[model samples]
Target: MEDSEKNIELKINQISQKLKEIRLSKGYTSYETFAFENELNRVQYWRIESGKNITLKTLLKVLEIHQISLEDFFRNL
Candidate 1:
């Protein structure tokens, strides 16, 4: 794979990991429960947590639940 591709994949993984950590910290041990409670599409939420098809809209929804902004979402990086 190209270096750029690897870099992108790495970033995706980082974002997924961060989101998972946040979910756990919020007292959700199950992604399904988190999704259901948050009114998110379960499969889409799973995709985001799995580092798959994460869309900006979905990320924004999660950030909203966390009471954070887009800047805060990226502030860790």
Candidate 2:
């Protein structure tokens, strides 16, 4: 793969890891539970945590559910 592609993949992995950590830290043992409670589309959320492509709108919904500000998310990242 090209350097740019590799970098993007690396970033996706990082984001996915962080997302998983946040859910676990919040006492969610299952991503499904988290998604249901947060009114998120379970499939889309799964994709996000799986390091697959997701829309910005969906990501914003996740942040809102977690009460995570964009600033805080980026800072943590």
- Candidate 1 lDDT tens digits, 1-77: 99999999999999999999999999999999999998998998999999999888888889899887889778966
- The worst-scoring run of ten residues by lDDT in candidate 2 lies at 53-62
RMSD to truth, every model? 0.8, 1.1
Query: Can you give the TM-score per candidate against the true fold?
Result: 0.94, 0.91
- In the range 1-77, model 2's lDDT, one tens digit per residue, is 99999998988888888889999999999999999998887888899999998567877778888899878887856
List candidate 2 segments past 4 Å from native: none
